[model samples]
Every structure is written in structure tokens, then in C-alpha cells.
Target: MQFIDLKAQYDQIERDVNERIHAVLQHGQYINGPEVRELENRLAEFVGTAHCIGAASGTGALLMAMMALGISAGDEVITSPFSFVATAETIALLGAVPVFVDIEPDTCNIDPGLIEAAITDKTKAIMAVSLFGQCADFDAINAVARRHGLPVIEDAAQSFGATYKGNPSCGLSTIGCTSFFPSKPLGCYGDGGACFTSDEILATRMREIREHGQDRRYHHPRLGINGRLDSIQAAVLLAKLPLFPHEIEKRRTIGRQYTEALAHDRIIPPVVRPHNTSVYAQLTIRVDDRDALQEALKQQDIPTAVYYPVSLHHQPVFLRPDAHLPVSDEVAAHVLSLPMHPYLSDEQIRRVTTAVLEAV
Candidate 1:
């Protein structure tokens, strides 16, 4: 079975997608079109944020947030080592050091308890990732940030539809950034992403940052990048927005089914927080012999993927011999993501689950 059934999802929305694309083509406003603003407004309302700034990609969103926050050389952004490299890469790209933190073994999200110890005079902000579609403990992380008078950037790339304490993922921190990559919970047809915030100034700054720091056309006030999301992508996302709530429910249902079916197996299903609901961006599990299990599943014609095979601290590019993150390292060696998406059929899920159980 496919790891993520994008084909199935596209089939469901084909007519709408085609219509939206046609409209964009007819308008010929490829850059900063009305559709872009429409998408931004819809996303802001969906996430309960005051503003949403569409960006080129999730990485662009993160980079724009950092630009707006003025993260620069000598500044330190504390983040987990277990997340996709983009989480740490964006910080390093800005000449800021990404101070590594361990993750909670169950959630695979940054450990808030380990954050304070890593904070120092240069600590400017906390970049907390919402891993595996479950938000990190924002309450704890925010508390720590508040004590230090630092802003918190929630990397909601994998948890856009997720919730924490009844609040949405992108609305949990000072600035929340999410991806619309095809595999994300609320994906567009292609690369797209957004940044959310309640503060008007920060929102304005982010908008400018996304457009090469232009206050007005041709007016450059600060250094920035070409991070604006294309109008066509915005149109596609707008078409997909109406179906997001239903998709979230379907994903949750599928996740529950997988958990129930695999509970007794040798592999461990993903853990959900008491006050949260994961959108199941990737219904990942921990296995004793991960590589062997993956091979066995492959032999059965079931596809599985490793979210990360190496911790950021262990990666050659960011390797720091002095840094140690045991939890992240352990998770890196054991976690495996199975087929996940709202469109996954019952038969498909059962087949994949059976293959996993048999492999174990």
C-alpha cells in the first residue's frame, strides 16, 4: 500500500482543484492574487489566530518567523534534536546556534523540562516542534519562555490540525508556522505554508519578511527572502480548506483503528496526550528491530518510512561531540511511520496493520 494515499485524496477533490486552477489561470494574477489573501484569511480563522501570512514553504514560514523575531548571529534558538532538520537548519541558516534539547520518549516532542538548562544569556526564543501530529506541552514550554521573557515559535508543520488543551496547534505559541506540503494534514497541491500570530506588529513584520522586507512595492526596509507562497498554491489550498475538518476526523478515526489493531503486537503504537487530538500526519510506531521489521513489511508489499534515521546532533552537518541527546538518538533508531492519510481505506489500514503484526 502507499505510504500516504495522495492519489485517493486528489481524486476526491479533483473537480474542485481543477476549477480553482482554472480560475487562477484565467485571472493571470500569479503573484499576490486575491486567492492568496483568501487563503490567509481562511487559515487565520481556522487556527483562531489574528493573522496568517502565506509563505513559499514550511521552511520559508520558519525562516520568516525567525526574521521577524530578529534572530541573528550570536543568538541561540533552543529546539529538539529529534525533528526534521529544517527545524534546526532554519536557525543555523540565520547564523544562530540551535541549542539541542531531548524529546519525550512517548510523544517524541521536545522535552520542556530540559529546555531551561540549555538556556543562557544568548537564548532569544524557544522553537518547539509539534511532532507526529501531537503538540508539544506548550503550557510548560510557554511558561519557561515567559519566565525568560522570550518568545516561543511553534513548529506546527506536522500538527496543523492538532489540538492542545482545546486550542489549535498553530495558535499555541507566539508565532506558529505550518507546512502545506502534500503529505501534511491540510496540504495544498504543491509546496505551501503559513505563519500565524495574534500580534499585529509581528504579523506585519512577517508579511514584509515573506516579500523581501517590502513595506510597499519596491520599498525594502530590511533583509529578507523571496518566501511568498504562489497564488496558484493558495488557490489550491483554498479549495482544500472546506474539507479539512472532515479530513481531521477521518485521520483521527484511522489512527484509533491502527492503535486498537496493533496494541497487542510487538510494535508500540503512537501515544496521544490526554488533552490533545493528533491529526495523525504520520501514524508512527516504535519497534524493537525497526530495520528488520521494515524489511519484512516491504516483503509483504507494505510500505513503511523512517521519519528520521539520525538525530540532528548526530548528523555530520550539525554534529557536536560535546552535545548528547540520548532520547532523540534512541527514538531515531526505533521509530517507523506507516501508511497514514485521511483517505486511507479500512481494507488498506487492516492490510498494513496485519503486515506489521506479522512482521513483528
Candidate 2:
């Protein structure tokens, strides 16, 4: 009955989780510990990347990636406006502008066809956010970037375990960033993140940036921040990583059930592309009257949520006065997320589908 039932997931792996934490406690190397490196290695191999740099948080990972690329004031990063604030926040934090792009209404991912028009001399990168665990069109996006000789960064925070055209989400772009927030598809016990890259030079730069621009012990090279993942979180992630593949399959199964059951309802279920696999971070659906639908489901003791009610371009802090993104704006107002998790049973899914059908 809960949204993203982490408690039930924890119950399934409590013994292993407890042992991992115990090992971390016994080692007492909370900062830059052995477990941290091990987790980074495992993550790199899993994502099919040459290097994985551990970070304190997903936001920090994005910031470091941008920094490593030399993005600075007066530069612009082309990105979609229908994602988490962190997608745009990192750009603005560097005194750079976030050039807004509209998303496809079907997938709520950035529309690559519109990307070319946004590029300019100041355009430093293309940050494509994989919203709701589905990847953006990396092939098309990368094509555009290649034409313009620009680097692309994939915000794979929601779609960590997902696949886009047989390639892993986090390994599809010039630099991929993912979060280990407890609610993400692949998560740790606390805030953690990683940046993945095949370019060894960029990887080396990011690694140095994660440690206050250190080339060696206490030797500063450039401006950077403290963005290393702590040991305890790494241990938790190591314990959780083994269960991710099966959990992703379960999530897909549940997503399929929701789509099938709601095919004829008032709501429009998520649309995943043929070659893509979504991890279903949030099984979001759309309706004309989202608030009313949510209330109706609530009356039946069914929990629901909205992924994002406000588009990033409309955020008061980073408002774009000349912005006009109709599809993203409409999606922001209509999208609603249902209770979705790998732990959801058939009975639980049936209860949710019944309430939704009746409500809509």
C-alpha cells in the first residue's frame, strides 16, 4: 500500500545488510575506506564503464562532472525542463545558463529533434535526464552532439538499472551520473552517487575533482569539492547490488500489469519504447483531472504520488522569462505516480488497479 516499499525490500535482505554494516563498523574507515573502492569497482563493471568515481550525492556527481568539463560562468548547457531540479540546479550553480528543451509527451524525455536549434557557441554540454526510469533517445541525442562536437551527460539517477538499445543507461553518454538515494532503483542506505565515463582523461579529472582537486595526498591541482562517498553507504550498496537485476525484472512485470489493467481506463499508462527497458522508478500515469484521481484512489486506501508538479524552467529560483515548453508544462500538470515497487504482490497490484479503474 506504500509508494516504493523499501521497508519490505529491506526485510528480504536484513541479514546481509546487517552483516555489511557490521563489517564497515569493525573496519572503522568511514572516510575513503576499502569498501568504498570495492563498491566503485563493482559499479563500474556493472555499468560497463572504464571508471566509476564515487560521490557524496547525485547532485554532487553532476556538479563534479560539469566542473571537470570546464563549464563556467557565461556558458550554456542544453537540457530538458521536465526533470528533477538537480538537473538544472547544477548548471546554475556554476553560474552557467540551462537552455531549456521540450520533452516528448509520451515518454516525458527530452526531444532530440529540437536540440540542434538550442545549440550555440556557448553551449558546453547536453544533459539528458532519464525521467521515471526510462532513458531518453541517446542515439539521436548523441548524433546531434557529435555533429556539434559536444559532450553529453546522462542523468541516469532514475534509470540506473535500465537499458537503452541494449546498452546500459549509465554507460550510453560521454559522462553518466547516477544517485544512490534510498528511493532510487539502485540505492544505498544513505545519500551516495557515482559518475561513469569511458574517457580515461575525463575520468582522471573527475576523480581528482571529487577530492578537492587533489592530484595526490594534500596536493591541490584545481578548484574542486569534497564529494567522496562514505564507507558505510558503500557497504550498504554492496549488499543491495546483488539483488538489483531480479528486482528490475519484477518492476517491469508490475509495470506491464498496470499498463494492461489500465488500458481502457481514464488514465494513460507509461509508454516504454521497443528497444528500451525501464526500471519503473515510479509507475506514473496521466489523467485530465490528476488531483481528483489521486483523491479517489486515496479514498480506497491506495497511495499515489506526483513525480513533479512543476517543470524546472518554471521553478521560481531558475525561471526563464522567455520560456515556452507546452508539452513539458502540460505533462507537469497531468502526471501522477501510483504505488510501484518490486515487492508489490499480485493482490496489491490488483487492489491498486481496481481503485484506479473505479476512480477514473
Candidate 3:
């Protein structure tokens, strides 16, 4: 069985996708075509935000948010180490320091309690990653940020359709960034991403930053990058957007099946918060011997992956051994993501679960 089954998803939306692409081709305005603006408008409405600015990639979206927020050298952005490197990479790219914070062992999201201690005069923002398709504790994170007068940017790359306390993931923070990497919960045919904001001024700034700091043609207001998302990708995403709610429901059903079947096994299924719903971007689990279990599953033709084998603080590129975050370290050694997607069949899930149970 395929890991994500993008082919099945494509088949479901083939007609709509073809129509959208045909229109884009006919228009021939492939750069920042009309489809781009349409997608931004639809996504902004879906996320309950005032604005959405599509970017080249999720990493580019984060970089644009940082630039719009005026993060610079010597500034510190607090975030968890138990996330994709882009969470911290964007901060460092701006010559700013990423203050590593420990995550909650259950949710694997940044611990808000640890955030206050990390704040200083240089703390400009809180970059909270909604890891593994679950939203972080935005209420608590926002409380801390409000106390410190810092903006919170939600890295909702994996949790686009996820909900926390009835609010959408991207609408829960000062600024929310999500990716359209093909494997994400809501994705396009190619690399694409968007930044969302309720603040009009910040939204205006993000729009300018996304197009090389230009408020209009030949006018450069500030330093920015070519972060615009392509029209073809926008068209692909627009076609996919209409079916996203149904896909999220399918993913939830599959996740529930995995949780019920694997709960008593040697592996631990992903944890869900009381008021939160995960999109199950990765149906991850923890095992005693991750490597051994992975091998055993592979022998059965069941694929598995490790969200991260090494924490950002421990990466050779960072090389900061003194930065100790215990939860991230422990999780890196134990966490493994199983085959997950809306297209996973009941039989495939059963087979994968059976293999996992036997292996452990």
C-alpha cells in the first residue's frame, strides 16, 4: 500500500483539477494569475482570517512572517525543538536566535509554562508549531504572549484543517503560516504556502513582503523576497480546497481506527486534546525499540517513518550541546509515524496495525 495515496486523492478530484488547470493554461498569466488571488481569498475565508498571502513554500511563508514582524539580529523567537527544522530555521535565517522550549510529552507542542522564563527584551515572537496535525494550546500561549507583548505565529503547516476549541488552527494566533507541500493535510500539486493574519496593517505588510517589498510596480518599500506562490499551484490548491472538509473527516476516521486497534499494543498511539481534533497528517506512535519495530514493519511491506530522528538543538548544524531540552530528546528516540492519509483503507490500516502489534 502507498504511504499517502496521493494517486487516490487525485482520482477523486481529477475532473475539477483538470478544469482549473485548463483555465490557468488558457489565461497564460502563470506568474501571479487570477487563480492566485482567488485561492488566497478562499483560504482566508476558510481560516476566518482577514487576509491570506500565498508564498513559494511553507519555509518562505515563515520567513515572510518574520520579515513582516520586523524580527532582526539579536532578537529571540521562542519555539519548541520537537518540530520541523523550518520552525527554527526561519528565525536563524533572520540572524535571530531561536530559544529552544520543551514540549508537553502528551501533545508534543510547546509548553506555555516554559515560555515565560525564556522571554527577555529581545523576545519578539512566539513561534508555536502545531505538530503532527494537532493545534498547540493557543489560549495559554496567547496569554503568555499578551503578558509579554509578543506576537504568536502558528506554524500550522501540518494542521491546516485542524481545530482547537472550535476555532481553526490558522485563525488562533497573531499570524498563522501553513504549507501546501504535497503531503500536508491541505496541499497543492507543488510547493506552495500561505500566511494568515487578522491585523490589517500586518496583512498589508505581508502582501508587500511576499512580492519583493513592492506596494506597487517598481516601488520598493522595504527588504523582501520573491515569495509569491505560482498560479498553477494556486489552481491545484483551489480545486483541492473544496474537498478538504471531507478529506479531514476521512483522516479522522482512519486515525480513530488506528488508535482503537493499537491502544493495547507495545506502541502508543497519538494523543488528542479534549477540545482538539487532529487531521492526522502523521499517525505517529511511540515504541520502546523504534528501530527494531520499524524493521519488523518494513519486512511486512508496511511503511513507517520517523518525524524526526534528531532534535533541532542536537543537529550538527546548530551545534549547541548546552541547549538541553529533555522532552525533545526523548521523543526523537521513540517517535515513529505510520502510513497515514485520508485514502488509507480499513484493510490496510488493519494490516499495518497487526504488523505493528506483532512486531512489538
Cα lDDT of model 2 by residue, 161-280, tens digit: 999999998899999999999999988878999999999999999989999999999999888999999999999999898898999999999999999999875688999999999999
Determine the backbone clash count of candidate 3: 0
> Compared to the true structure, candidate 3 yields what TM-score?
0.99
**Candidate 3 regions off by >4 Å?**
none
What's the number of clashes in each of the models?
A: 0, 0, 0
Among residues 3 or more apart in sequence or in different chains, the pairs in candidate 3 whose N, CA or C atoms overlap within 3 Å are none
Q: Rank by lDDT, highest first.
A: 2, 3, 1
Model 1's TM-score against the true structure: 0.98
Q: Could you tell me the lDDT of residue 2 within candidate 2? A: 87
Can you give the TM-score per candidate against the true fold?
Answer: 0.98, 0.99, 0.99
Q: What 10-residue stretch in candidate 2 is worst by lDDT?
A: 259-268
Candidate 3, residue 351: the lDDT equals: 96
